[model samples]
Target: MEQTHSRVAVVTGGSGGIGRAVAERLGADGMNVVVAYSGNTERAAEVVKAVEAAGGRAVAGRADVAEPDEVDALFDTAEREFGGVDVVVNTAGIMILKPLVEFDLDDLDRMHRTNIRGTFVVSRAAARRLRSGGALINFSTSVTRLALPTYSAYAASKGAVDALTLVLARELRGRDITVNAVAPGPTATPLFLDGKPQEVVERMAGQAPLERLGTPDDIATAVAFLAGPARWVNGQVVYVNGGIA
Candidate 1:
């Protein structure tokens, strides 16, 4: 792969899990990175150090993806530090699982606030600021297609993301920017494994023909492709689920 030393990438939720992997991968690909975190300053700092250790430029910025002002500042940090924005990967979201009838409205509201509204806020900024030839990558869930139980609200949010990605791609015609979403399934991240039992994890892992869970690096690889070489792949939801969906 050719090094993209001239490109700049902004990755939200970059402190941990898949977001961290995306940040590190883009930095390794020779892009200057802005690691945006909501709260975890220590972890965000660690990601910045990792990127710099790999001989790439990086900085950590604290921003709530749902807030327009903070997101604006995040883009500003990238521009002020790295020259301009080129790639934006929004991996910031919250997932709450429960049957639709039994789900709490408060939880639903909170999840939508982060998952739906946050994606919109960040994406709107990218649409306005990303340089030509830039890519905007959003996170989605394979459950939207899987139609799995207890994923109604989560699925609904990602469904909205799918719509946003496709529409935005067309809206940017002739601008040379790509808008896309990555829908991952049953990834073995702290966010997915925190409360599930081992048997439940095993069962879901077996659902995929590959018979395993996805790693953060697996999702990161797809994001890196869209961010750099996959220029023709736009306005599409690329499923990286090991064929489970």
Candidate 2:
């Protein structure tokens, strides 16, 4: 829990598109990054290699952030391999699209378990034990603001994340830590393009004022900002959507 020297950052879902970008950005800032992944071990390792290639220190591990024990181990591993943890960025989440009436309870349960419960578990760990000047960055979605169709369950889960970040910021008022959420609009990631017709996807992308989909690096910039020197920012949800919503 040392915050004085170079900091350590744990980024959940660091194997994925946006998570990889954020991890790399934090590493470039002279912080050691712990790339936490749930399923993609090889991808996580590749991310670690990339970080190292950039002259940054990084390690890859597996953990289901929704589980307390796993999260504890994740932190312990990061602290043990590196020195200590000073920042946590949660980018692990899933999205299922369905009409409200047709949304299955099973899907809701799974999504909630990862998106909401995962944030609660990992964030609590950060608040309780992370060193002073640490930052906890959570993820939400712009769908919550747009109230887009077929995003009922997903939006609900992100709404919970938003609420949690705000409350935790106040709860840790004197801790010299910041709690915030990054809500990305539409990003051109593999997970986002699946199961959609090209025309439909293009139409969706065109909806944004930028006239294109966002890149993982775009959201990563916001994450790196909140996780690095944005100490004055807390309990805020920064939407990196390119004016989509």
Candidate 3:
């Protein structure tokens, strides 16, 4: 993905599809990784093993990224276990699809709690803790641009991430850290495929110029670039979709 070195990364939602791929990618790139999750420690442990199998160091932890204290402890674990943190990838999120008019306020709240508030918590910690030459990779979605139906609430939450990530990059000023968001489109992940009909999924995939849904590894490649050599690309949302526009 990029050049390798002695680096430490804290990847939230590491138990999930894209997060797991990103963690493994970073680990293979020669970084120690802290695979953080909100629940399902078993899946998180599996990620830790993947990282180690890639010839890098890794640990797993539980942190509800929306909570400040849990997030604080996550970064603390990174430092205590790996010496320092150079990369922070906030991938923990939840998605519930419904027309905005019929959308359950409760579902919206739950999604925002993780997608927006959770992002702020991790960004806040990364701002204070990430070592120089660090990178903060936050996840957004192409739906914000695609304006797909039933994605309004989810898009709004990720819109906040786009705004927050950009502003945080500037706030870092001389910190030598790059803050950016990765906006993946129609990715092949449990989060995206769970409730979709096969025909519907195929239609979505066909719309992309590449004629296939983006794989987790495709998005992970983008994150790896941001985490390493793409130092000049800050305060931006890098879309990893296959020409989805």
Candidate 4:
């Protein structure tokens, strides 16, 4: 039934900063979008409206990325409404910074549940369900490379994501789906800025050669590229961190 038409996308965390931006970006690119938010239906509704205003068809669905049944239902909704799924952008995540020695095990569990476990669940769904020529774009962080203090747990969780992404790319060989992860450094998202102080923010901003924080839209552009045009660029983690290692 998906004949000679625009591709569809499912954007998890569509209510958050980076997720919201990517949804709008893909909408502008003329893809029918399904915005999946774990909570906050109001923010999700706003995203749906913005996507529509951008000239792309969109709807909102509620699903926790870590929950397979919920994500399956989300994909079902996308197909039922937007035709068929072609791109899946998994951006839902959580971060709790602390020294590794003193970090609470519970926090590690929570972060892993959201970041590592969530990626696996959603990527699995995408793998089994996406139409040919589809894409799976997962999120990672430059902290895995930076190895900064208080980021050990976060980095560890994302390291697992990187591993899974690499293997999944090969596992989906011959399927025509490009699986890749985008590792962003010090992005200007509310999730990143929520607890950091001004001095810390400025220091991080200075670390980038661009002398500024990367915006959600910057990351979104990377997602859009991987989602649509970067056909041969698969099984890799594209760092969109302004030349930051």
Candidate 5:
């Protein structure tokens, strides 16, 4: 890999497992990171401290990516404080697992609002304000390809993201911007581990070729590639699943 230079990157949901890893990796890559968190101010602050300790500049802020006004303010804050956004890695996501017949309508709607709508809100802002040669990265999941049981609603939301990434890539063709999605499989995050039995978790991990669940660093490596020095790879969903799907 080439040496990384200083830049600014906005990472959403950046206080949690995957988000924190991506933010730190980008910081290590010499980017000023803006850690966007939805609910955990303390965790977000901790991430900022870690980034700074790694000799990278970073700050934490709150924004529900599903809200347009909040999203606008987030961009404004990044531009106002750290210059401008050179890259955006959207790690914000939600997973509500239940069979289609058993899933409640409110759960489905909330998932869609956060996963689908939130990605759109952030990507739309990025398309308008991202610096030249910048990149916009969205998150999807391996479930879209795996078609796992009880994943219909969640996969549908991410499927929208997969399609939207392609559309946005074409839409930004003349601007030298790259749009892509990172689809991770069975990662060992709180979101992935929550409510699952130990046996079930181990089984999922065993499905991967590496016979282990992914770590935050595993997904962050892919996001870093897309956001910095991988501009030529565009409009695709790169699966970081250890070849499970």
Candidate 6:
């Protein structure tokens, strides 16, 4: 594997939301970054520019996390541009909220494809390619623990992520790589706020002890810890939910 003095990170869904924050935070920490986006080439390019402006090297690539070939190419981009990957943050996922009885199977399948299978594909590549001392960070949700109504399908999908993170962490034993998940609650991102009414958002925000919606930076700070100095932390789901759960 090619190696470099600076650590390198590949952040899926890195064009916006928590993923974009993670990419930018890692770059600000002096790591080379590959910002992978499913669509929105312009936003991805903006992230790359932001990273570079922060005094870090970065490149943006388009990849569908659910597709193995695309994910492989994503990792290849990391290696080609940054030498080697020291961190893999799979923050690419979709959420559809509905009561189980009212949920559409197609939506469930779509969510599973991106949230579960996408994680698996990326984790598989990271397992084989990450250098020693690397970290694999997956995204989950506090809803898995909150068990809120209308979030049945979305919660179920993240529950799988929780399971995957723990098991994969153990499976990567002896590799000196840590696998973990960050579960955020009531984050004020476009994904979480797109359809909710202001009242509903405020109610959920108040559920957390912090009494406000979490900013992307709040979650990214936790990810930065896992990716950089939290070596002793492994196979754990660090909930950055401000005590919501």
Which parts of model 2 are misplaced by more than 4 Å?
Answer: 1-3
Over 32-129, each residue of candidate 4 has an lDDT whose tens digit, in order, gives 99999998999999999999998899999999899999999999999899778999999999999999899999999999999999999999999999
How much does candidate 5 score in TM-score?
0.97
Global lDDT of each candidate: 0.94, 0.91, 0.94, 0.95, 0.92, 0.91
| Candidate 1 residue-wise lDDT at 13 | 96
lDDT of 1 by residue, 1-245 (tens): 35354899999999979999999898899889999999999999999998888667999999999999999999999989988999999999998899999999999999999999999999999999999889999999999999989999999999999999999999999999999999999999988998899999999999999999999999999999999999999999999999999
lDDT for model 1, please.
Answer: 0.94
Worst 10 residues of 1 by lDDT: 1-10
Colliding residue pairs in candidate 3: none
Give residue 114's error in model 1 in angstroms: 0.7
Considering only N, C-alpha and C atoms within 3 Å, which residue pairs clash in candidate 1?
none
**2 against 4, candidate with superior TM-score:** 4
- Candidate 6 Cα outliers beyond 4 Å, as residue runs: 1-4
**What's the residue-level lDDT of 97 in candidate 1?**
92
Q: 66-139 in candidate 2: lDDT tens per residue?
A: 98999999899888998788999999999999999999999999999999999999999998878888999999
Please provide, for model 6 over 87-193, each residue's C-alpha lDDT reduced to its tens digit, 9 standing for 90 to 100: 99999999898889999999999999999999899999999999998999999999888899999989888889999889999998999999999999889899999
Assess candidate 2 and give its lDDT: 0.91
Please write out the lDDT profile of model 3 over residues 119-182, one tens digit for every residue: 9999999999998899999999999999999999999999999999999999999999999999
What is the Cα-based lDDT of residue 182 in candidate 2? 96
Q: Could you list the CA RMSD of all candidates, in the order they appear?
A: 1.7, 1.6, 2.0, 1.5, 1.9, 1.8
